[model samples]
Target: MDITKGYSIAYKGLKNGTHDFAFKVGGALFEAYGSAEIMGGDCDVEVKLDKSETQLVADVTIRGDVVVACDRCLEECRVPVDFEGRLLVKFSDEVREYDGEILWLLPGEDEVDLAQYIYESIVLSLPYQRVHPEGGCDPEMLRRFRIVSDKEFAEIEDRAGAEPDNTAWGKLAELKERMEAGPQDDEK
Candidate 1:
C-alpha cells in the first residue's frame, strides 16, 4: 500500500461526525519526507477527526520506536516515541497557517494533507539529546575513550597539583645529589 497517501483527511466526503484513521509509518515514511534528523522508525499513528459545520478538530496520537543516532557512540539506537498533538482546521477565504497549530483552508477545499503535521509531531516529540541509557554505549568505543580520558585526567592533575621544584629537571638534580652523598652516609 502507498503509505504516504493515507495522511490526507477527506472531510468533504464525510458527514458531520467523528472519524478514526490508522496508519503504519516507518523508515520509508521519513525517507520519503526527505528527513535527515530521523532516518527510520516503526510508528503507529491514530488520528481522531471531529468534523462540525464550521471547523474540524484532529487529535493525533503516535506510538512506537524510532531509530536515531546515539549522541555518545554515534550508533543506531531505538528510542520509543509516544506523543499526542492537536490541530484545528478552519475554513477561510484564503488558505494560510497560523501559530503552527491552526490550518486555514478555503471553503471548497476537499481534503487536507496531514503528512507534514505527522512528521513534525513525531520529530518535535523526540528528546533534544538522544543517547543510550547509562553504560549502554558500544564497549569498544567506551574503552578507547576511557583510556584516552584517563591520560588526559592524569596530565591535568599533575599540572594542577605539582610544586615548582617537582619538575623533571629538578627531580634529576635531586637524584644526582642523592647518588653523590650515598657513600659518605654509609661510612658515617
Candidate 2:
C-alpha cells in the first residue's frame, strides 16, 4: 500500500450519503511530508463526508498533540491540538483552487487528496508562542533565564536614563530640531 495513499478519499465509489473515516497521522506521515514544523506527535483526524450529486462537504476534527520547542525554557514540549474545519469539494470542468477551505476537482478526478489539508490544520492549530504550562518547564532553566533576563533588564534600565550625545539617534534628534528651527535668527 502506498503510505500516502491513505489520505485520499475515493468519493467516486461512494453513494450519496455521509461517510466517516479516521486517520492516525504523525511519525511516518510527518516524515513522508518532510515537515519540520511538527516533527513528532500523535494526531487523530476524524473526517465526516457528506456527498451529494455535484459536491462533497467534509467536516474535519483534529485532536491530539504535537512536539515543539518551549518558548520559555527552550526544551521539548507537547502542545495539544483541537480544531474543527470544513472542506468543500466541487467538480468542475477545470481544476481550480478556491481557498484553503474549497477545492475544485476536474470532471474525471476520482479522489481528493487530504494530506496537505490535515497537516495544515494540525500545524495552524498550534499556539503562536509554544510554551509549557506555568511551572511545568524545567526549574533550573527557568531560574537561569530569570537571572540572565533580570540582569539584562537592569542594564537596560541603567542605560535608559542616560542619553549619550555621540549616538546616531541623538545626532538625528539634533538635526531634526535644527531643521524645525530653520534659521531661527531671522524668525526672531
Candidate 3:
C-alpha cells in the first residue's frame, strides 16, 4: 500500500467529529516534489482532522531525522526536525478568502488532497539556516572553520578602526612629528 495515502482524509464521508491519520515519508516522497535536497530517511507525520458543518480543520505534526550535509565539513549529518501547524479548509461555490490560514475549495470538490499541505508544513519546520550545533560538529572540520573565521574577524576589526594601512598611518605620524620639530609647513 502507498504509505502516503494514509495522510489524506476524505472529509465528505466523515462524521462530525475528529479523525486521526498518520504518514511515514521517505526520500522517495520528497523526490516526487522535484529537486528537493532531502536524504533517505523516515519521518513521522500525524494529522488530526476535525470535521465541522462548514469546514474542516487540520492540525499536523511532523517529527523525525533528516540527513543533511554539514556546512563546514561537507560530511553527512542527521538533523532532527519537529514542528506543528494548522490549516483550515472552507467549502464555497466560488473561491473566497477566509483568512491567512484558511483555504477555499469549490463546493463541487469531493475531496481535498492534503499531501501538498503536509509536505509544506514539514518543509517549513526546518531551520532557516541548517548548521550543526556548536561542539556537535566534527573536530577537524571545526578547526578549519575556526581558521577561516578568525582571519575574517581580524580583517573586520581592522576596517572598523578606519586605518587602511596600519604601517602607513604610523609613518605619517612620524612625518608629522618631524615637521613639528622643524619649520612648520603651514607657516611657509
Candidate 4:
C-alpha cells in the first residue's frame, strides 16, 4: 500500500457539519516525498474540519521531532517540530492550484489527500538553525567540523592576503590579481 494513503480522508459521504481527524506521521511520509533535509520523523497531525455546502475549513496542528544533520557538528540531531495553521479547501470545475493557504479540488474527487500539506507543515516548523545544545554534540564530531570564530576567520583572511611573499599564498594572490585585471590585461 502507498504510505501516503494514510493521510487521505474520504469526505464524500460526510454530513455538512464538523468532523475531527487524527493521523500519525512517520518516516514513511518523508521517504515518500524523497526529503533530503528530513532523515526521519514522528509527528501527530490533528485536523478540525468544518464542512459546508460551499467550502471546507480545517484547523491543523502538528507536533513532533525530526532528525536532521546538525549545522555545527555534522551529526544526526533531533529537532523539535511544532506548527499550527488553517487550510481552506475549495472546489472548482476548472483546475486550480493549491496556493499554500487554500487547497483546490475537483468536484469529482472523493478524498482529500493531505500528504503534502502535513509534510510541508512539519518541515516548515523546524528551526532555521538545527544544532545540538551546548556540549550535547559528540566531542569528536564537533572537533572534526569545528567552526572558526569570527576573529580567527578574520585573522586567516588577513594572513592569506598579507603574506604575498609566501610561496602558496603568493601564487594565490597572483592568480587573484590576474583574475581581477580581467581578460584584456591578462592577454597583454
TM-score of 3: 0.64
Q: What clash pairs does model 4 have?
A: none
CA deviation > 4 Å runs, candidate 1? 1-3, 145-188
On lDDT, the leading prediction is 4
Alpha carbon deviation, residue 67, candidate 3 (Å):
2.0
Estimated TM-score for each candidate: 0.73, 0.73, 0.64, 0.76
Candidate 3 lDDT over residue span 42-61, tens digit each: 78988898988888888888
The candidate 4 region of ten consecutive residues with least summed lDDT is 163-172
Error of 1 at 100 (Å): 1.3
Pairs in steric clash, model 3 = none
lDDT of each model, Cα atoms only?
A: 0.81, 0.82, 0.71, 0.84
lDDT measured at residue 94 in model 3 versus the true structure, 0 to 100: 81
Kindly provide the TM-score of model 2 when superposed on the true structure, using C-alpha atoms: 0.73
- Cα lDDT over the full model 2: 0.82
lDDT of 1: 0.81
